[model samples]
Target: MNHGETAYGLWSLVALNSTVFILFAFSFFKPATARDWRSFGAFSAFIVALFVEMYGFPLTIYLMSGWLATRFPGLDLLTHDSGHLWSTLLGETGDPHFGVLHIASYVFLGYGFYLLSSAWHVLYHAQRQHSLATTGPYARVRHPQYLAFVLILLGFLLQWPTLLTLLMFPVLLVMYRRLAITEEKNMHKQFGETYDAYAQSIPRFIPRLGKARLTADAEPKK
Candidate 1:
């Protein structure tokens, strides 16, 4: 595509992509609590901001146009391909979508969504039974859903490093962390020793290197 056919002013694509991803996440997340809604709302705002710069307007590119032109002479600033800042910065050629970081972004996004879905499933069933969620992704990490959100945000950063989204990333991390701590406190109150034992065994956000011994059926040792 020519410069005229490239980034900026494609509001339709922006809206379409944003809607699809937000709906996809909403279906998986099914936010019920105020905290849940807050997290999801923040994520949704990030998505919309990302696509807005991605398709609606190339704000980052426009802001950096002079420096980018001086640094990488003859590069087409208007093209969508040029928006893949990681690929351009890394000096990778050809299609940016097929670049290493781009491919890695896909991996992160796919796995992130998968984790979101799986975590929600386990949490839903556990909530229904009023039991601690220790199955599936929860068996590995205490906050799989929050971890999934981080991964997804990282995936976007890899794909398109916009100024706004990059700034929002660390803020979102802190928010998720605080939310996880609050959730853990509530869980401890409700499940008492069971949650304590589970929390002791499983890391809050990261999984242990080895296989997790904890399972849904495993009884917490008194």
Candidate 2:
């Protein structure tokens, strides 16, 4: 529980965690196109940055040490638990992993990967038939894969608040949004009126409640 001395400076742990997560996401995302690689690369970079600060350097804690020490005098900056900045900031004294933010992070991560996998399955089948992907997760949102990446990033941000990753988050969001727009254009070219109609009915990122759900034969996937 107390990783004060053994928390940071573990390069192996940083690499292990980063590789595991990046590979897990890769397996689900299966980046095939150049655009897909860009999105995957950005997400991989975020995972690496997060793990680097989490188990390798703890740069955020080092930079904010003085402030954190003054703010919470009894806080141990080097402890793994202290790295859960959300818990610390919220005055939660128990194990950071069991905290509310941490629990929510798990939910985000679990569902994010699940959504990513589900979206890929739908897209893959549709692509094989040279058709649009309008079923499953796509029916809920136009860009489920992009939304999955956002949720995953948000999950990591919730678990570990690092300055570098926090800055990268918004940049990734903008990048994904632009990519989504480009993809939508491509879909429009391919599916024409069908895609346009689906776009009108389905929301982009957020799911519209009480709205009519798109049928299996509805819109094209991003």
Candidate 3:
């Protein structure tokens, strides 16, 4: 294996990538509460873990080296292209960055950040008015922020599947779900029938197709 082709041990790249993504997500999500911080913190950890393996050290690759060599002897596991395991496993030739899974990962990441920004805008306004967020992306789902985080995580997984991130993904999902549920309970207590009505008409995560039922407060002002 050409030592020049080996992609790991770039600690600078790992730190740079992690900071860029974490800060980007932070600018959009803007965590305010303890729960928000906890969720954001977990997401940040996932990002750091992903980039760490991506540049600093390929622990997943190292661990699976024996099996990988046996399975695909021609493969150069130390090279960056080999890190795109989905492409390698699927027998995709040429640039892994241009592969189908990689392309789809971009879609997920783009939409995820978009959703996060949109959700934060609506949520920030609602918090200012001391009201429930049932407008914009919130009209589609009660927890757009959580959904955005999930999408981002999935995008990273698709782009580069790591042992640690794959394991953390499901656990983070459960954590976000619990946070959403707990948030809903608080909303119910605060807004009572109004929250109930909103909750009844609008689903929590998976958005309903077609027209979204909007309360008077949620309706855009003329």
Pairing residues by index, what is the TM-score of model 1?
A: 0.95
lDDT (CA) for every model shown? 0.91, 0.89, 0.91
**Residue 41 CA error for candidate 3 (Å)?**
0.8
TM-scores of the models, in the order given: 0.95, 0.94, 0.95
User: What tens-digit string does per-residue lDDT give for candidate 1 at 1-222?
Assistant: 235457788999999999999999999889999999999999999999999999988889989999999999989988889999999989999999999999999999999999999999998988888788887998899999999999999999999999999999999999999999999999989988778888888899999998787634345332
- lDDT string for model 3 (43-83, tens) is 99999999999998999999999999999987889899999
lDDT, candidate 1, at 214: 64
Could you give me the TM-score of model 2 versus the true structure?
0.94
Please report, as a residue range, the 10-residue window in candidate 1 with the lowest summed lDDT: 213-222
Question: For residues 35-139, could you state the per-residue lDDT of candidate 2 as single tens digits?
Answer: 999989999999999999999999899999999989998788888898999999999978889988999999999999999999999988988999877788888
Ten residues in a row with the worst lDDT in model 2?
A: 212-221
List the candidate 2 regions with Cα displacement exceeding 4 Å.
1-3, 215-222
Off by over 4 Å in 1: 1-4, 215-222
Task: Provide the lDDT at 33 for model 1.
Answer: 93
Winner on lDDT between 1 and 2 is 1
